[model samples]
Target: MKKISSKMIFGILTGIILGITMAAYAVSVPSEQVLYSNSATSETTVNGALTELLNLSQECKSRCPEGYTCTEKKLCKRASTSTLHTETCMTGSACHVQNNYKTYGHGDTITYGNISTTAGTLKAGDAFDCDVNGNGHYESDSERFYYVSTMNNGHMRADSNIAVLAYAKTSNTYRLSSGHISYNNYGNTSYGPQYALNELYNTTQWKNAPEIRSGHITDSSGNILKLNFSYSGYASRLLTYQEVSAGCSIPAQVVSYNSVGVMDSGGPLSYSCNFLLEDSNYSNSSNSVYYIWLESGVDGRNDSAFDIDTYSSNVSYDSVTSMNYARPAIEVPLSDIDY
Candidate 1:
């Protein structure tokens, strides 16, 4: 009805068109509201929405116990109390476990064949008896002698038939018999042998006594004969009549002998005999000797011998002044001997 203007009309139409375009753009834009059924667009919008929500949640106060704290990953955990416990914590992959023990008591005596100390420690003046093994009791006196039986346990007799007369002095405190005889006589003597207070002045009989010694004998034909001899010594003291009944025998020869020296005590003393024939008639016999002495400082008699064969049939011998002083004697074959 009034005067119309083209400029005003054009401005109005432009404003209306712009408003419509803004409304259309808002409606078409993607939103997190879409279900995953939308595939590509749904994953992108949902991730963006989750990130914004987490950031907002962190800004709020945590609702956990006083001793607990919220982790960066939005989880609550209690604080650890002890560092030691944590350090030693075991896992399924790591673990371990241990087991044997030993005991020393009575009936566990330290026995050296014929001689045995109490289950405890040994001291001076302890009285002991030397039985079948030739181990004698300890005595303060230097000049003491004992007759000890040296035999195998399996062959031991109640009568003490087999034994060696061993002597000892302060200067010679060890056994002087062969190791073979000493070892075999362990635990086989009855009541044990007592020590004689008097010192044995001479061992002439012991040294020259019947023994199987080994040596080479040359015949008149210049042929050497490897021989072993069992010869009796004349210097030996006569066995008491009672001793003879108990298996002791009289010496075959009589000769003056010297006292046993410290050097001659422990060793391999062997004597062997070979008869020399003059035109089929036996004329003379020779005995060879073999001996080895151990240089141990202890005073005692430790000796041994082998049978006809040097390599086998061995026996041990032990000589101690007293049962308390004796130790286990050893007799090993030359081929099987080891320290």
Candidate 2:
């Protein structure tokens, strides 16, 4: 099984320790008028430079970070309002829009990606109806989906990737739903993470999305996204970790769940993990193995492994190994779907 290095494990444990013990939050609102820089609000450059730490609020006067815009005395992602646009094609076509956005927390900050849409067709018995068999579900020529992660609130906007539900096989023994990815680390190392995500990006309906041959995509602003297979990274795959690791600035917050059936915060996490981890029969199929990485480390006091329950919707874990699967996630602007 793929495993992480000992040093990597130590660093992850250290980072989590700092995350919990440090009374000051890296992005929390401050009392003083904090002078901030664009780099300070980065996930990739967690320990990067900042001459002065600025106060985090929507009401700041200065220019906020790249993905984030200043508003209400704090900093939030910029242009996130347009992350997902709904266009009902009254003219008998699939409803689609050109959604261009900087994927938060994956990679660089300036790279603005785009999505292309063609509009949904009329469901009233047209050639390609929403439901040809009359299942009541709109079966347009294609499905509409957000380019970004699932959560609605974060450093950047969610619903950025316009995707459709699809499926693909991993090993000869495993078949999983398309578009499955992990936001956090599995072991101390990425532990063979990128291959599955590469498969999802190349094999699924999102196959046509804007991406370079290097397994990376560039935005309109000329930023080159150089992503990596990372473990022991930050939490919140939606914006912070996914964006930074994917080569952008916007950070995604992980969906939090207080209970198995109850959702406290991260809905997209549940959607992706549940869809992929749960078998076609919904009975936790051992056929499709899943080895996911989590951003949050194990409470050192509890065990030697990390807390990976956040990665799977139905499965809980004290430890895992290589026979399992580790999925990676990335984003492209819905507008860039055509670009």
Candidate 3:
């Protein structure tokens, strides 16, 4: 009802415009507290996911035991302690023999070949508890062996993944069936060491031991012969000539005699063969003289196989029919040992 005026009209329009502007600003701008709360939730979600991923990566790593190292395959392996090789004389004692002997932190004798002696902790020369004589008793003096080497599962025996090679403390005599035979032929035949060892697997003497894996046999000339067994392989067989004389700088030889039939040469015993020499008391007793068979057969001579002659303390070859010491060697699964 008041008289119309420009100033009044202008004031009324200005107030309405200002009120609308303020309401639009209030709708668009959220409170500082609200903004901070929303931001925190987003950051928390992202950070939590990152933390979980880090935890998973850490859980996947493997921890190796003492005296072992972690291989690139994420498995545990035996670590060599020293370059120096030595033997421990365990004569007339609970442990019959120890080769490549190295004193562990604690002088502990593994009474059984089970999980108690963890495979990772076993170094070369560690005595493994086994039933050697088939007497139904796992005695240290009866059928025990000292570890000679450690290898991957498929390296030696296909079934024995992650295995250790063990050598006998003493020797046992066995006769190779009389014949003019080559290594390849002898290994395939039932009368040879290759098949003879497998036959023992069915007996108490080697019922528990893992069967031998077929391997190559090399002669003194570096010629290779396959031990293609008809069955899985040998159960308890003799050491290879290469393995026995591995440590020798001037390795011994295996040869056929001339028309007159005489050994052509002699050489130093290998570090491994040295162990057998001392344990057998070949140095002290003349009666202890004997020949030990090697897995290798003479390269050029089909009638002969390599042997360790006690008299000369060197490598030699003898007639396949000759009776020789069958020093059993076995590759056992790592899982059989206890930690």
For each candidate in turn, the TM-score is 0.16, 0.27, 0.47
Best by lDDT: 3
Worst 10 residues of 1 by lDDT: 272-281
TM-score of 1: 0.16
Question: In angstroms, how far off is 11's CA in candidate 2?
Answer: 67
Q: Please list the C-alpha lDDT of all candidates, in the order they appear.
A: 0.22, 0.27, 0.44
**10 residues in a row with least lDDT, candidate 3:** 31-40
Instruction: Estimate, for each residue in 177-245, the C-alpha lDDT of model 2 and write its tens digit.
Output: 333333213433223233334223232333333331222221212122224323222111212233221
**Collision count of model 2:** 79
Number of the candidate with higher lDDT, 1 or 2: 2
Score candidate 3 by lDDT.
0.44
Model 3, residue 149: distance off in Å is 3.6
lDDT of 1 by residue, 266-297 (tens): 11111111100001101101211111111011
Regions of model 3 farther than 4 Å from truth: 1-126, 131-138, 150-203, 215-227, 231-234, 247-263, 270-273, 278-289, 334-339
- Candidate 2 lands at a TM-score of 0.27
RMSD of each: 39.3, 25.2, 21.9
Model 3 C-alpha lDDT per residue in residues 13-112, reported as the tens digit of each score: 3454465568766675322212111211332332343343345334334454333333422112222223112333332322221233322122233221
In candidate 1, how many Å is residue 269 off?
21
lDDT of 2 at 146: 21
